[model samples]
Target: MSAHRMSDPLDRRRFLTAAALRGATVVGTGVIGATALGAVDADAVFAAPLRRPLDPAVPAGAFVEGRITSIDGGVLEVAGSHGDYARVRVTGATSVWKVRPTTAASIETGDGLYARGVPMPDGTVAADAVWVNIVNLHTTIRGIEKTRLHLAHGSHEIVGNLLPATSSASYSGAAPTADLSGLRIGQGAQVLGAWRPSDDSVDIVRVAVGPGAGHRR
Candidate 1:
């Protein structure tokens, strides 16, 4: 059966609209805060930090992470990381963010995605928000300087730059602190940052350093 036909038209629209609005509000607040913190370039702060992974035991609606295989109309066919398949339906109200808040048109096939939305009975996820190509990396700090950290994520060496006013660090989930002086060379850290569109570098948003730090999303 078609996923779109499973719900009452009005009710489905209302649900999706509410979900999208909520997602937009969340992203909008982050962007405003980043801007206030000297992130003058919209693209630099578009991908806000995702502090932790969603709990698998929680009953929160659907959260899908994967690479997009195809786009047909407003629907995206995704090949999930865990070998599952998902059909994500995007709508006019869907909040899509790449490096910054953008329209759904900015999404492309082969892009990696993380989507939050309501799962429909017919197995399609009605997406409220989608983040494209955002990367959360756990690595060891090989070296550090006043403005950059040289990191080793597996075999890849990543250069992460600290945004002066927006970059922050947290210890063991405590409140984030602007002072990054506590970071040490060879420490394990997790970086919540945006991957450069065509490069291996990242623009650091928040760094979490402590025990068990090399956790993947």
Candidate 2:
């Protein structure tokens, strides 16, 4: 069976149930961050706020953000962060990454998402890429060890794990290097990583140190 079809049916069902409940609550309560976009302009919407502009060769599309409301087959229904609703069509060509290359089966309801895709005439988005539950956090290092860094993000404590062969650190915003020995306790850092669905832990993709640590794209 294809990996996409490998998600446990029971898990999907449970996720769908929870998603429905959450969607209703979100709608009724009128959450603070939810806003509706009457019309979407993909290129303008998906552009990363802090990152460098994407290549001009890329086609324009709507950028959608919010919690997953439902997933039926390959269509993902999302309640936009600003109160808009969007249907994102995911195909085999779509690149799904969350700190690393991943499959569509890994997606679950209630998870946050950022998707970039061409907007269809029908108002749906033909997604070319999706980043699920990715977080860029600016925090201070509370403690450090050989393989993990204890961080303070507001009032919450975050545990960041350095993934061997994949994790690296950057001084300023220069090229990333594998050496993390320069990282120190009580230092300010910015972490770009994927949040674990089960806990406050994050699997680090890259760590930035120094005054401009967390501001880089």
Report the lDDT tens digits of candidate 1 across residue range 26-62: 2222332221123233343233222222333322367
Runs in model 1 lying further than 4 Å from the true structure: 1-14, 17-61, 69-73, 82-85, 97-109, 120-124, 154-156, 171-174, 211-217
TM-score leader: 2
Alpha-carbon runs more than 4 Å astray in model 2? 1-60, 211-217
Per-candidate TM equals 0.56, 0.65
Which residue pairs in candidate 1 collide? none
Worst 10-residue lDDT window, candidate 2: 25-34
Candidates in order have lDDT scores of: 0.68, 0.67
lDDT per residue for candidate 2 within 61-89, as digits (tens), equals: 46889888898766789999889999876
